[model samples]
Target: MLLADVVATSAALAATRSRKSKIAALAELLTRAGPGELPAVVAFLTGQPTQGRIGAGWRTLAELGAAPAGAPELTVAQVDAALGEVASASGSGSAQRRTVALRGLFARATQDEQRFLFRLLTGELRQGALEGVMVDAIATAAAVPGEVVRRAFMLSGRLPVTASAAVTGGERALGEFRLALGRPIRPMLASPAESLEEAIAEHASAIVEYKMDGARIQVHREGDEVHVYTRTLREITGSVGELVELVRALPCRSVVLDGETLALSDDGRPRPFQETMSRFGSTRDEQVRALLLRPYFFDCLHLDGEDLLDAPLRERNNALRTVAGAHLIPGESEPGAPAEILESALEAGHEGVMVKSLDSPYAAGRRGRAWLKVKPVHTLDLVVLAAEWGHGRRTGYLSNLHLGARDPDGGPPIMVGKTFKGLTDELLAWQTKTFPELETRRDDWTVYLRPELVVEIELDGAQVSTRYPGGVALRFARVVRYRPDKQAHDADTIDAVRATLKG
Candidate 1:
C-alpha cells in the first residue's frame, strides 16, 4: 500500500467528529493493509511511530522486499534519503535500498498524495483513533477476540508483534502466550471514578491500594541488572540509577515490576507529581543524582519465569509482597475494606487510593473498569499569575493557567504550578473572554493574568521544588473556580504550605 493512501485515510478519519466514523475509517484501512503492515499503519494513523525517530512505514516498506538479517547499518542521512523517496514512489525497490530510495520516489506523487505523504512521513496524522481503537479494528479484521490482541500485546512486549501473531496463529495462540523482556507491553492505566464507593460497587472483588502523588514507571530487571521506563515506554535507565540499584537488591532476581517512581522527601513521603515528572527525559546527571527517588511497586506483571498478569489481584499482590518486600505498596486488601484503607492511605500522606478489580487480568492498552482512582478534593485559595494559549482543539482559549500561593513574608505570589485539566467548556469560554481584560502583558503564546484575581484551586499534593519561586510545587493543580468572594490577602500563605509539606 502507498504511504499516501494511509495518510489520506488517516486525515479523513481525523476530520470526522464522530468516533464511530473515525473507527469505521480506520477499520476499512486495516482490512486493506498487509498483516505485517497493520501495526505500522495503526501507529501512523494515531500520529505515533512504532520505534526510532523515523516512520515505521519506511521500515515496513523495506521489509516487503525481505531485507538482510543483522542490524542493518542505518544513519540519519540514510533515513532522510529513504523518507524522501517513499514520499513520491510506489515504495518499491530492493529491500536494502527501499528505505534509502524512498526520499526520491516520494517526489513523484501527485499534489494531494504529496500532502498525505508529508503527514505520514512526519507522523502527524492525528486522527481521533488511538491504539485501543486500532486493536478493536485489527481484531475485527483478523477474526479474533479483542482479548487475544490484548494478551498478545502483554506477552510479546509489542502490539505489532501481537497483531502479527494473531494474524498468523489465531486467538487461541495469544491466550496461551507468556511474557518476555526488553519487550514492551501495552501499559495498563486507570480512569477516574465518580466515587470510591461507586468504584467498589462496580468492581465487587477489587484490591484497594494507596495512590501516591508520583510518576508512573515500569521497571524491567534481569538478575542483577535493571532498566526503568516511563509510562510512554521511553527507557530512562540512566536517570534513576538509584532505583535500579534498589531493584537489583530485591530478594527475587529476573523480575519485571509495574509501579510508580517519585521523588521522596527525607521522611519517605512522595514529592509533588510535577517534581517527579521533571525527572523524565532529563539530561543532567547531577540533577538525577540530587533527586531521591523511591520505587513503589504496586503490581507484578511478570516474575521468576511466570506470567502473573492472569492471576487474580490478590494472588499478584501476594507475589509482589514476597518479591518486593518493603518496596511493595502497602494495603493489599479487598474492595469491601477500601474505605478503611483509604483512611490509612490518607493518614500516611498519600493522595488517595487506587482500586483494582481482583479478578481482572492485565488489559494491555485498554482502560477498562478493571482499575479506578479516587482522590480527596483539596481546595485552597490561590492567585493566578500567568496563562498560556491552548493548542489543537483548545487553540483560541487561555488554557494553561499558572498558579501561585501567597508569600506571607511578602514578595510575589510564587508560582506553584500550572494546569489545563479540570476546566469545563463554560469555564474555558469565560476565561477566553475575560482573561484578556486581566492580562498584564501579552505574547504570542501566553497572557499574564493579573495576580489580583484570587481563585480557589485544588491539588493532589505539594512537594519541595527548585523551579518555583516559593521553593515548592503543586501536584495536579487546577482552578476550582474563581474565588470572587475572597481577596488576594486571604490566599493561603507559604507558611500554611510549609506546614502541609511538613505534615
Candidate 2:
C-alpha cells in the first residue's frame, strides 16, 4: 500500500471520537495490506517506526527541511527502509546520513503525508488510536478471538508481530505465541485503590504484600541462559549481573518470574528510588558495588515446561515460593490482615502495599482491578498539554504546566487541571528550554505542546469541574517528577482521575 493511503486513514481515524470507527478504519486498511507490508503499516498507523527509536528527536526532525510533494509516490516499504537507515546510522557522519535519509523520505510525501510523518517520527500520532484499538482491529481482520490476539501480543511484547502472525495464520498462528523460556512478556499492572481497606473489601480473600518503590523486572531463565527485562520489555541482563546470577542458582531449569528489584541500604531497608535507578540505569562496575540490587519475587508466570499464567494467584504464589524460595516477597497479610500489612509496609519505608484477590489469574498487560495498589498519597502520570511563562522571580521561565489525563476513548488527552507548584529552578530552566521544541502552536498566555511527555504528579485528589474538558480537575496537583522513563501513551487515563473523585 502507498504510505499516503495509511496517512489518509490515520487522518480519518484521528477525526473521529468513536473507537468503533477508528477500529473499522484500521481493520479496513489491514484487510487491504499485503502480508509483508503489515508490520510497517501497523507501525505507521500507531505513530511508531518499525525500527523503534531511530534517534530522531524534535531537533533532528526539524532539521529535515523538505518541501512536500504535490503528489504522493512513496510506498510503505520505502519509508520503512529509510527509517531502518536512520535506526542503523551511527558513529561518524551518522547525523548527516540520517538528515539525508529523512529529507529524501519526507520530500516525496504529500503535505498530509509530511505532517503524518512528522508526528509518526516524533512518536505522537494523535490519531486517537494505538495498540489498544489495534488489538481489536487485528482480531477483526484475522477472524480470531480478541483474547487470543491479546494473549499473543502480550507474550511477544509487540502488536505488529502479533498482528502479522494473526493475519497470516489466524488462531493457529496466535497459538504459537507462548510464554517461552528466556522471553519476556509485558508485566501485569495494578489499579490504584482508595485505601487498603477498600482493596481488602473488594477482594475478600486477599494477599497483601509490600508495594516496593523499584523498577519492575521479569526474569526468564532456561538452563544457563538468563534474561531480565524491564516493565517496557527492554533487556537489562547485562547491567544487572547479580540478578542473573541469583536466578541462575534456582533449582528449576527454566522459569519466568515477575517481581521488583531494588538496591537496599546497609540496614536492609529499601533505598530511595533514585538511588536504586542510579545503579539500575548505569553500566559502571563501581556503581554496582556501591549499591547492590536484590530481587523480591512476587509472582511466577512460568515454571519448567508449564505456563502458570492461567493459574490463579494462590497457585502461582505456591509455584513462585517453591522456585524462588527466599527470594520471594513475603505476604504478611492474608484475608483479614490488610491493615496490618499496610502498617508493616509503611514501617519498612516502602511506598505502600498491594491487595490482590487470591484466586485471580495473572492478566498480563491488563490493568484490571484484580490487583489494587494503595499508597498514602495519590499520584498520576499526566501529559503536559501546555505551559505558561512565569512572573515575579520565576519570570522568563515556563513555570506553570497545563496537565491532561489520557482519554480512554480514541481521542486526544483531555485537560484535567494545571499547576505551577513543585518545580525546582533546574526544572524550570529545563522546561523553558525544552517546551518550545515540542510546541504545536502557542497563544499569548499558554504555549501548547504535543502531548508526548509524561509527568508524575502528586495530587490531593480530583474534583468535578466545569473548567476542564475532562469534566473533572486535579486538586492541588504538583509535579513529583518528569518521568523520562515513560511516554504520553503510558499516562493515567481520565477514568483513574475520576475514580479518585468517586472515592
Candidate 3:
C-alpha cells in the first residue's frame, strides 16, 4: 500500500467527529493491507512507527526542513524501512544519520503526508483514534467480537501483532494469546471515586489498600531470574537491581506480581514521587542505589507454576501474601470501616485508598468501576483566559482550556494550568463559536480571550510548580463542566489553590 493512501485515511479520521466514521475508515484500511503491510499500517494509524521512539523527538524534527516531493511515490514498506534505519541509528553520529534519513523520507512525502509523518513522529497524532478505536477497527475487519479482541490485546500487550493475527486468522488465533511466565502484560487501572463512603457503598466488602503515589510495576519471575517492567510495559530489569533481587527472593519458584515501587524514608513513610522517579528512570547504578525503590506486592497474577489472572482478587491477594510475606501492601478485605482506613492512609502521608471488589478478576488495561480509587478532590471555579486550536476530530474547534485563578488582591487572574481532557465534541463546538466572539486578540496557536468564561474544574490537589507564574498548579486538573451561571469574579482565589499544596 502507498503511504499516500494511509495518509488520506488518517486525514479522513481526523476530519470526521463521528466515531463510527473513524472506525469505518480504519477498517477499510485494514481490509486493504496485505499480509506484509498489515503491521506497518496498524502502527502508523495508531500514530507511531513500527519501530517505537526512533531516537527522534520534536527538537530533532524541527531542523529537518526538507521540501515535499511533487508527487506521491512512497510505499508503506519503503517508509517503514526508512524509519527502521532512524530507529536503529546509534552512538557516534546518530543525529547526522537520522537527519540524512529523515530528510530523504520526508522529502518524498507530500504536504499532507509530511504533516501526518510529523504528528506520528512527534507523538502528537491528535487523532481521536488510539489503541481503543483501533481495537474496534480490527474486530470489525476480522469479524470478531470486541470482547475477544480486547481480551487478546490485554494478554498479548502488542496491538500490532494482535491486529495481524486478527486480519490473517480469526478468533482462534486471538485465543492463542495467554499469560506467559516472562511476558509483561498491561496492568489494571482504577477509576477515581468521590469518597471512601461512596467507594464502600459501591463495593461493599472490598479490598481496601493504601494508594501510594509512585511508579506502577509488574514483576515477572522464574526461579532465580526476574524481570521488572513499568506500567507502560517498558522493561527496567537492569536499572533496578534491588527490585529484581527482592522479587527473586520470593518464596514461589515463579511469580507475576503487580504493585507500586517507591523510595521510602527510614521512618517508613513514602518519599516524594519525583525522588522515586529519579531512580526509576536512571541508567546509572549509583544514581539508582542512592534512592533504593522497594516494591510493595499487591496482586499475584502468577504463583509457583500456575497463572492466576482469571482468579478473583481475594485469591490473588492470598497468593501475593503467601509468596511475599513482609513485602505485601498494607490492606485488608472487610477488615474494618472505610472511614477509619482512609484516616490511617492520610495520617501515613500516603495518597488515599483503593477499594476493589473482592470477586473481580484481574481485568487488565480496563479502568472499570469494580476498582474505585478514593482520593480527596479539590474543585475550583476558574476562568478560561485563553484556548488553543484543536486537532484531529476537534479540527476547527477550540480545545485545551487555559485555566486561571482569581487574585482578589486587585490583580489579574493568575494562570494555574491548562487541560483539554473531559471536553465533549458538543462543548468543543460551542467553545469554537463563542471564544472568537470574546477574543481580545489572535495569535498563531492560541486565541487570547477575555476572562469572561468560568469553568468548574475537578482536581486532586495543587503542587508547587515552576512553569506557571502562579508558583502553584493544579494536579490532575480536568474540566468537570462549564459554569454558564457564574462569572470570572466567582472564580476561586489563587490562595485557595496554593492552600491545597500543604497538609
Candidate 4:
C-alpha cells in the first residue's frame, strides 16, 4: 500500500470525534493492507514506527533540509525499510549516517507524508488509534471477535504482531497466543478506589494487600533462564541480576510471577522511588549489588507448566503461595475489616492497600474494578503540557507547571490545572534544563511542551470547574514524583479526574 493512503486515513481519524467512525476507517485501511504490510500499517496508524526510537529527534529532523516530493510514490514497505536502516545506523559516525538515511527518506516523501512521518517518529501523532480501538479495528477487518483480538494482544504483548496473526489466520491464529515463558505479557492493572470500605463492600470476598510505591516487574522463569520485564514490557533482565537470581531460586520448574520490586532501607522501609529506579540504569556491578531490589510476588500467572491466568484470584494465590512462599506480599484474604490493613500499610511507609476480588481472573492489561487501589492521599498521573517561567527566588527557572489529563477518546490532552508546589531545588534545576529540550513553542512567560512527561500529582480532591477544558480542576495539587516508567497515554484520563469531583 502507498504511504499516502495511510497518511490520509490518519487525517480522517484525527478529524472525527466519533469512535465508531475512527474504528470503521481504521478497519477499512487494515482490510486493504497486504499480509506482509499489516504489521507496519498497524504500527504506523498507532503513531509508532515498527523500529522503536530511530534516534531521530526534533533537532535532527529540523536540520534535514530535504524538500518534499511533488507526488506521493513512497510505499509502506519502502518507508519501513528506510526506517530500519536508520535505526540500525549506530557506530562512531552513526549520527551522520542516520541523518543521511532520514534525509533520503524524507526527500522521497510528499508534504503530507512528511508531516505524518515527522509526527509518527516524534511520538506526537495523537490521532485516536489507541490500542483498544486498534484491537477492535483488527477484529472487524479480520472478521473475528473483538475479545479474541484483545486476548491475543494481551498475551502476545504486541499489537502489530497480534494484527498480523489475526489478519493471516483469524481467531485460530489468535488462539495460538498463550502464556509463554521468557516472553513478557502485559501486567494486570488496578483502578483507584474512593476508599477501602467502598472497595471491600464491592466484592464479597476481598484480598487486601499493601500497595507498594515501587516499580512493577513481571518475571518469567523457564528452567534456569529468567527474564524480568517492566510494566511496559521492556526487558531489564541484565540490569536486575538480583531479581533474576531470586526468581531462579523458586522451586517451580517454570513460572510467570507478577509483582513489585524496590530497594529498602536497613529498617526494612522502602527507599525513595528515584533511588530504586536508579538501579535500573546502573552499569556498575558494585552499584547494583549495593542497592539490591527486593521482590514481592503477588500473582502467579503460570506455574509448573500450567497457566493460571484463567483461574480466580483464590486459585492463583494458592499457586503463588506454593512457589513464592517467603517472597509473597503481605496481604489478608477475606479479612473482616480492611481498615486495619490500610492503616498498617500506611504506617509501614507503603502507599496504601489494594482491595482485590477473590473471584476475578487475571485480566491482563485491563484496569478493571476487580482490583482497587486505595491510598491515603489522592494522586493522579498527569502530563506536563506547559511550564511557566518562575519569579522571585525561583527566577530563570521553569517553575509553575501546567498539567493535563489524558483524553480517553484519543484527543489532545486536556489542561486541568497548574501547580508549582512540592518542587525541590534540585527538581527546579532539572526542570529548567529539561523543559527547554521538550519545548514545542514558547511565549514570554510560558513554554509549551509535548505531552510526553508523566508526573504523579498529589491533590486533596477535584472540583467541577470551567476554567480548564476538562471541566474539572485539581484542589491543592502538588507533585509527588515524576513517573519515568509511564508514558503520556498511561496518564490518568480526564474521565478519572472528573470522577474525583464526587469525593
Candidate 5:
C-alpha cells in the first residue's frame, strides 16, 4: 500500500481520543498490507525499523533520500520479500545502504504514505493503543484470534515473526512455538496497588519481600558467558564488568535471573537511590566500572534448559535460591504488621516491601497480581506552581508539573519538586485544556501557572537537595491525587518537611 494510506490512518488515530477509533484505523492498515511487507508494517506501525533493538538505526533524514533511478517498482509484497534479503546482507555499508534504499522507496510514495511510514517507524501512533491492541488488529485482519498471535510473540520474542506467521498460516500455526532463552522476552511488571491492606485482602496471604532501592536488571547466563540487560532490555553488560564476571562464575550452565542492582553499604543496607542512578546514562566504561554494585537475584525465570516462568513464585524462588547461590537477595517471611515491615526496612535504610503472590507464575510484560510494591506513605499537600507540555504520546497535553510547599516565614512558597509520573491520560488532557487559562506566560513547552491548585504529593522519602527552592524537597514524588478538599494556604509547611528530614 502507498505510504500516504498509512499516514492518513495515523492522522485519523492521532486526531481521535477514542481507543476504538485508533484500533479500527490500525486494523485497516493490517488488511491493506501484504505478507512480505508485514515487517515494514510492524516496523512502521510500531515506529521502529524491521531490525530489532540492537540493529543499526536510521540516523539522518538525508540517509532516507529518494529511491534510485531504474530500480524495479516496489510493491507492498516486494517490501515483505526484502526482509530476508536485508537480514542476510553483510557488512555495515550494505546494512546502511539497504536501510536508505528502503526508506527512499517508501519516501517516493505519497505524502500520506510518508506520514504513515514516519509514524510506523517512530512507533508513537499515540492513540492510547499499545502492542497488545495492534496484535489484535493484525489477528482480526488475518482472520485469526489475538491469543494465537500473542502466544507466538511470547515464544519467538519477535513481533515481525509473529506477524508473518499470522498473515500466512493464521494464528493456529503461530501457537505451535515454545519459549526459549538468549532471546530476551518481555519482563513481567506489576500494576499499581492502592494500599498494602488492599493487596493482602485481594491476594489472601502474599509473600512480602523487601523492595530495595535499585535498578531492575535481568542476567542471562550460559556456562562461563553472561549477558546483562536492564528492565527495558538495553544491553548494559559492559557497564558492570564485575557483576558479569560474578554471574559467569556461577555453577549453572544456563540460567535467567531477575534481580535488582544497588549500591549497598558493608552492613548490607542500600545507599540512596541517586547514588546508584548517577552511574546510569554514562557512556564511559571505566566510570560505570567504578560504580559500586550488588546484584540481588529475586526470581529464577530460567534454569538449565527449562523455562521456569510457568512455575509458581514459591517454586521459582526455591530454584532461584539454589541456582543464584551467593548472589541472591535474602527475603524472609513478612512481618505481621505493615508498620513493623516499614520500621525494619527503614532501620536497614532500604526502600519498602514488595509483596509477591506465592501461587502466581511469572507473567512477563503484563503487570498482573504476580507482584505488588508497598512503600511507606509520605503525604504532603503542595501547590501546583508550573506546568510543561507533554511529549510523544502526550503531545498537545500539559503533562510536566512543578509543585511547591508553603513557607510562612519566607517571601515565596519553596519549590519542592516537579513530576511527570503517576498521571493518567485523562489528567494530562484535563491539565492541557485547563492549565492554559491559568497560565502567566508560555515558553517552548511549559506554561508558568499560578499556584492556585493544591495537590497532595506523596513520596518515598525526603533527601537533601539544591534542585528545589526549598533546601529539602520530596524525593521520588508522585501525585497521590488532587487535594480538592485542601486550599493553597492549607498546603503542608516546609517546617513539616524539615522535621521529616530531621527524622
Candidate 6:
C-alpha cells in the first residue's frame, strides 16, 4: 500500500467524531493491506512506527531540508525499511547516519506523507486511532470477533503482531497466543472511583487492597529463570536484580505475578515516588543497596504451569497468597466496612484503596469497572499561564492549560505542569472565549495569558521534577472548576505543591 493511502485514512479519522466512521475507514484500509504489509500499516495508523523511537526528534527532522516529492511514490514497506535503518544507526556517527536515512525517506514522501511521517516519528499524531478502535477495525477487516482479537492482543502484547495474525489465519492464528513466560502481557488497569463507599457499593463483595504509590511490575518465573517487566511491558530483569531474585525464590515452578514495587523508609513507610523511580535508572551496587525495592504481589495470573488469567479475583488472590506468602500485599477480602480499609491505607503513607470484585476475571489492558481505585482528591487553585490550541475533536478551541503555582516572593507564578484532561465541551467553549480576552501574547500553538484566572485543579499528588521551575509537578491533574472568586496570589504556593510529595 502507498503511504498516501494511510495518511488519507488518518486525516479522515481526525476529521470525524463518529466512532463508527473511524472504524469503517480503518477497516477499509486494513482490508487493502497485504499480509506482509499489515503490521507496518496497522502500527503507522496507530501513530507509531514498527521501529519504535528511531532517535529522530523534531530538531533532527527540522534540519533535513529535503523537499517533498511531487507525487506519492513511497510505499508503506519502503518507509518501514528506511526507519529500520535509522533505528539501527547507533555507534559513533549515528546521528548523521539517522539524518541521512530520514532525509532519504522524506525526499520520496509527498507533502501529506511528510506531515504524517513527522508526526508519527515525533509521537504527535493525534488522530483518534486508539488501540480499542484499531482492534475493532482489525476484527472487522479480518471477519473475526472483536473479543478474539482483543484477547490475542492482550496475550501477545503487540497490536502489530495481532493484526498480522488476524489478517493471515484469522481466529485460528490469534488463538495460538497464550500467557508465555519471559514475555510480558499488558497489566490490568483500574478506573478511578468517586469515593470508597461508592466503590464498595458497586462491588457488593470485594477485596479492598492498599493502592501503593509505587511502580507497577509484572514478574514471570519459570524454574530458575525470572523476568521482570514494567507496566508498559518493557523488560527490566537485569536492572531489577532484587526483584528477579525474590520471584525466583518462590516455591512455584512457574508463575506470573502482578504487583507494585517501591522503596520504603526504615519505619516501613513508602518513600517518595522519585526515590523509587531512581532505582530503575542506576545499576551501581551502592545505589541499588541504598534503595532496595520491595515487591508486594497482589494477583497471581499463572501458578505452577496453570494459567489463571480467566479465573476470578478470589481464586487468583488465593493463588497469590500460596506462592507470595510473605510478599503478598495487605488487603481485606469482603470487609464488613470498607471505609476503614481506606483510612488504613492512607495512614500507611500510601495512596487510597483498590476495590475489586471477587467474581470478576482479570481483564488485562482494560480499565473496566471490575476494579475501582478510591483515593483522596487533592485540589489546588492554580494560575493559568497559557493555553495551547486543541487537536482533533477539540480543534478551534483552547485546550491544554499551562498550570502555575504562586511564588511567595512575588517574583512570578512558577510553572508546575500542563494538562488537557477532564475538559468538557462547555469548559472548552468557555476557555476559547475567555482565554483570548486575557491573552498578553500569542504564538503558533499557545497563547500566553495574564495571570489573572485562578482555576481549581484536582490531582492525585505532586512529585519532584526537574522539568518545571517549581521543582515539583502535579500528578494526574484535571480541571475541577474555575475558581473565579480567587485571585492569582491566593493560588497554592510552590511550597504547598512540594509538601504533597510523600516521604
Best by lDDT: 4
Candidate 5 lDDT score at position 260: 87
Candidate 1 to truth, TM? 0.65
lDDT (0 to 1) per candidate: 0.67, 0.86, 0.82, 0.90, 0.67, 0.85
Estimate candidate 3's alpha-carbon lDDT, on a 0 to 1 scale: 0.82
Q: Give the per-residue lDDT of model 1 (tens digit) for 104-200.
A: 4444444554444444454333355555566676677678888778667756656566666666567876776666665555477676565788888
Residue 201 Cα positional deviation in candidate 3, in Å, after optimal superposition: 1.8
Supply candidate 5's per-residue lDDT for 303.
Answer: 87
- Predict model 1's lDDT versus the native: 0.67
For model 5, give the RMSD to the true fold.
12.4
TM-score per model over all chains: 0.65, 0.93, 0.77, 0.97, 0.66, 0.78
lDDT of 4 by residue, 1-503 (tens): 99999999999999998889999999999999998899999999987999988888877887799999999999999999999999998879999999999999999999999989988887778888988779889999999999888888889999999999999899999999998888888878899988888898899998999999899999999989999988888888988888989899999899999999999999999998877877777466676558989999999999999999989999999999999989999889856757788888888899999999999998865578999999888899999999999999999999999999987777779999999999999899999999877776789999988789999999988998899978899999999999877888788989889888854
Q: lDDT of candidate 4?
A: 0.90
Q: Kindly give the stretch of ten consecutive residues in candidate 5 with the minimal lDDT sum.
A: 53-62
Candidates ranked by TM-score, best first? 4, 2, 6, 3, 5, 1
For candidate 6, the per-residue lDDT at 282 reads 45
Expressed as tens digits, the lDDT of each residue in 1-503 for candidate 3 is: 99999988988877875778888989999999998999999999876799988987665676799998889999999999999999999999998999899999999999888988987886556465667678899999999998889888888989999999898998999988999877899778776675787788886468889898677889999989899988777788877889988888778789999998889999988886657766755556675567888888889998888888889888988888898899888887766567777789888988788999988889864558889887775567798989999888887888988999976432447899999988988788889988876665678889877666788788888899999998998888998767543445456778768867845
- lDDT tens digits, residue span 17-135, model 2: 89999889999999899999999999888778898889777767777889999988999988998889999999999988888889988889898898888888876677876778889
State the lDDT of candidate 6 residue by residue for 427-473, as single tens digits: 89989998876665688999987676888788888888999977888
Evaluated at residue 195, the lDDT of candidate 5 is 68
lDDT of 6 at 244: 85
